[model samples]
Target chain A: MEENNENMTFENSSLAENTAVTAAAVENTENLNAAVENAPDTNAAMENSSAGSPAETDEEQKKPYRKIPKGLLWRCWFIFCFFQRTCQCFDRAYCNAFTYGIMPILRYLYKGREDEDEQIHAGLMRTRNYYLCEQSFSTVVFAIIIGMEEQKANGADISDELIMATKTSIMGPLSGLGDAIHGSTFRQIAIALTIPYCLEGSIVGALLMLIGMNITPWLTTLIGFPQGYKLGSEFVLKLLQSGKMQKAASAAGLMSMFIMGGMAAKYANITLSLTFKNDYKEIKIQDMLDNAIPGLLTIGAVFGFYGLIQKKVSTNKLILGTMAIGIALSACHAMGY
Target chain B: MSSTGITLLVAFILACYYGFYSTYPFMILMGPAGMGSIIGLIIGLIMGDPVKGIEVGALIQTMYMGVVGYGGVLPVDQFFACIIAIPLAISSGMSNESALALAAGFGALGVMIDTLWKTINTSVWTPYIDRACEKNQYRKIAKGAGLYPILTRMAISVPIITVLLFLGSTAVNWLMDNLPEWLQVGFNNMGTILPAMGFAMFVSYIGKKELIPFFIIGFYVMKFASLPIIGMAIFGAFIAWLVAKTDKSSDTEGGLA
Candidate 1:
């Protein structure tokens, strides 16, 4: 089994190496194409194009002279294109993906240095100890770090400590931002918009939910990547300090709560079928409860579970307890409780 | 299609969907709302009752609507539950409610599998990548980070899903045939109450002290007024906007509280 596993790893690594080589070739062709397009005249373009022989370009010029290459950014985005939850280890929550995604950019930045391999190794190891962030929303953090890496490689006197500290500090705010807007608010709204239609068996509703849930995350990644790289971390710090995000979060929280209330009333219907005989009327317990307060059972049940969750009772246990109680209640009702 | 072919096809779909959940495009389909509806639709179509399948799927989705697996920690695997429940409901002619109850249990099982996978990746793949980092082998690191997990995940999910689908159908059929009627009704009641837990989880998540009133107000208004949900959502957004504007004026006076 060990041998087979090793063999498979070897084959996979070879395949990945081939891809990397091809990617480098593709990037070179693109750069050359750009250089030709930008030249003032055809002769200058020919001279620029002929400045390097094909063999020399392959060996020596694979790494671009620019501080931050467009190809490297796209490569980072592609690496991030894979599910961010790909290989989560207990010790390092998301550091594996983080380090892996940034590898190409680091390689490009540190390419041709005195200790290129050593610098790459240090760069990977620096952030691999611990990382936890919202995958799509945290694209800004990745962009800022890549920007920092570029500066550091170009002799900007930036230390490894500063990079590490930036990562450690920025993740908390970004994760909170992501959790608030995307996780708590947009997700529920998407479901709210689609659930009614889906209940009617409309495929369009399902597709809408998919699109709605995804737009923000993808948009954040696409827009944040370039802006974060250009503006660096200060832009994010300014935005946070401006109190705009706070106000938005508050508004979103309010909207989420309101929508949640309506949804709970609409969907969280828990019917109590217990009824009793009275002197002059057939009294249904459900009717009495409804008369007192509309959707009272649903409201009570929601708050009850909310209290349990607040107490930090594991959701799994609550689900089981609910099922048990529900079954037991059904059995009692059958026995005319 | 033959039963074997159908089984293989469904098994393949589940495995691919579950295993490649984090991959591009598939990540969009990872949520309970998205996965449940699609899975329910597919299995329903297979059973020649597409609407019923969607109804079951929507029920599960509603029950799990508020569940956000933030930071990769699944509170319950609603998608896994749908996979188990929808097929059973469609194939064995079981009630949606009982199938939902059955799904609630399997959701826990899905979490266990996820935990086990994460643990294995921690002990095995993480160290392999660490060693590759030490050697400065980028290709090896990518393999450990990307390729290997998907393969191993497929290996783990395929057999589990296949076995569950084949055996689960029989088990549900037997339970339906032999279980007392009251217990079945109990399961249905449980399903009805399950959505309460979803809303409860959402309320707990978003319900700060100041924000709690909105939920109550939203509930009662929804109850009494009988307004469309979309219209209510717009009113909520407008009210929220007004609140923010007032709060901003207060913040200007009080200075960043």
Candidate 2:
């Protein structure tokens, strides 16, 4: 039994080494294609390369074992994509670390080899470093990217230590970017756009916001998986530095601001009911303000809240303050003052 | 069926489903069902009054808009609040503004229950998952990861929601009948003021000085033109796209220099 175990280990290492060489070759060709595709005048070359790649054809014929089955790919996608916030215990030691970051790769790697208990245990431990981070918009996107790279390296010569290290290093920056763009900007825009519709009791607005918020993460998983598997983390860094992410975020931010302004005017209902009994006519404060500057009170209320926030007032405090002021004013109005 | 009975039945089901979905499993459905607007729509359908249901839902939703559970700290329990307050309000003939106030107050209290749930989950179920992984029982690990947390959540949430629904309607009716008019008016005022707070929270999250002008533009357009909110949003999108185009061109020029 001992001799047989040794022989198995030897065979596995050699197979992995051979697979690594093939992966490197595939990576090089892909990088060249990507570079050409990015240039302005290489549209035709890009089309030709995509349509019929010599390297791809050679890889398909020679390295059949390297190809992940379609069913398995989809199953992996489903597990990692939806189970993003699983395992969020108090410690958060693996904060979606297992379900989102590691489980998909484990499933793909251990597909037909589930009997290898030792290998499974080893894989779990190796992937089980501190994986806690904020739940940003890109959380799932980064998880898919990292999981795909692990799947790509399953039979290759990459060490478990190296894979673990790569995951830890990338999560911080990716989450930061995602938080700024997806969490804060995109989500706000979705809310701003949909709130009006929701206020008017339109289900269409709710559906549109749900779809709009999900599209990016959905597309990221679909596209990031294959690309990460083929080119690894290099692709992720390049994608970030390309400036497209920033541009998209800025556009969304600008749009969100505009919609919020409109939302304030339409929804933030504040009117002065105070009227003065003069000799000739009773003067209504709200109507006069409206005639002078439409939405004056709404704008003022928004700025007032903004000023409180700038003064470092907590959200709870601000909520209570608004409520107190509103009630006080309403009571005064009720007295017909 | 009596209004209270109908409310109890619907609230119980919504609570059970919400507890399960909020955790690990069935997250896809959670998105739409989780929102106050959708919950209101569902309540409306159950009560055979979609219009009033929607109005109440929209009012309640604005209070909790842009609020999310980040880093395991649930600021408010929107699900619990909606389940308890919506049904009771609808059944008791409470005004939408009063319903909003009730829901917001319940949402704040529900935060404690949420914390307790998370604490139990961390201490009890998580260790089981760790042990299962160590034994290399992948199927057990899967169950521990997904099923256990959900069951635990439902166990706590279902009974509490059931009790709330059964008793909540009567309680609301009593309060409405006996409460002083001044306090009632205060609660109604909260319905209007709470949305302002929600908008303020959103601004604090994403506001930048450079973007303040766009907000003013949006406000005036809506106030003066009387265009629908959706129409204003489309116009905002166009302006954003134009701004992005110009910004990109300027960036390229700077790079060349």
Candidate No. with top TM-score: 1
- The regions of model 2 sitting more than 4 angstroms off are A1-67, A93-115, A132-155, A179-181, A185-190, A278-281, A291-293, A310-314, A334-337, B1-7, B24-30, B46-48, B70-73, B245-257
DockQ of predicted candidate 1: 0.46
Per-residue lDDT tens digits for candidate 2, residues A243-305, read 567667777777888887788778877666688888999988878888898777767777787
lDDT of every model, 2 decimals: 0.70, 0.62
Taking the tens digit of each residue's C-alpha lDDT, what string does model 1 give over B34-153? 356656776566656677777788878777766767776778877778777877777777777777888888889877777777887899989999999999999988988888877776
lDDT of 1 by residue, A1-337 (tens): 2353344344443433343333333332332222222211222222223343465476336544346678779778767556356787678887878778889888988877789999999898876777777866567888888877775665444567667766766666677777777777776677777777777777777667667878777877788889888655544454444456656767877887887788777777777878788888787888788888868788888888888888999878987898788878888783213
For residues B1-257, what per-residue lDDT tens digits would candidate 2 score against the true structure? Answer: 35444455676776676576556342323354456766766766666655566667766666665565533456677776776777777788788878888887777667666677677757876677667678876776666666666677788778887777777777788889899776777777767767776666566666567777887898788777868767887999999988777766787554210
In terms of lDDT, the best-performing candidate is 1
Error of 2 at A204 (Å): 3.7
C-alpha RMSD over true interface residues, each candidate: 2.7, 3.7
In angstroms, how far off is A207's CA in candidate 1? Answer: 0.7
DockQ of 2: 0.46
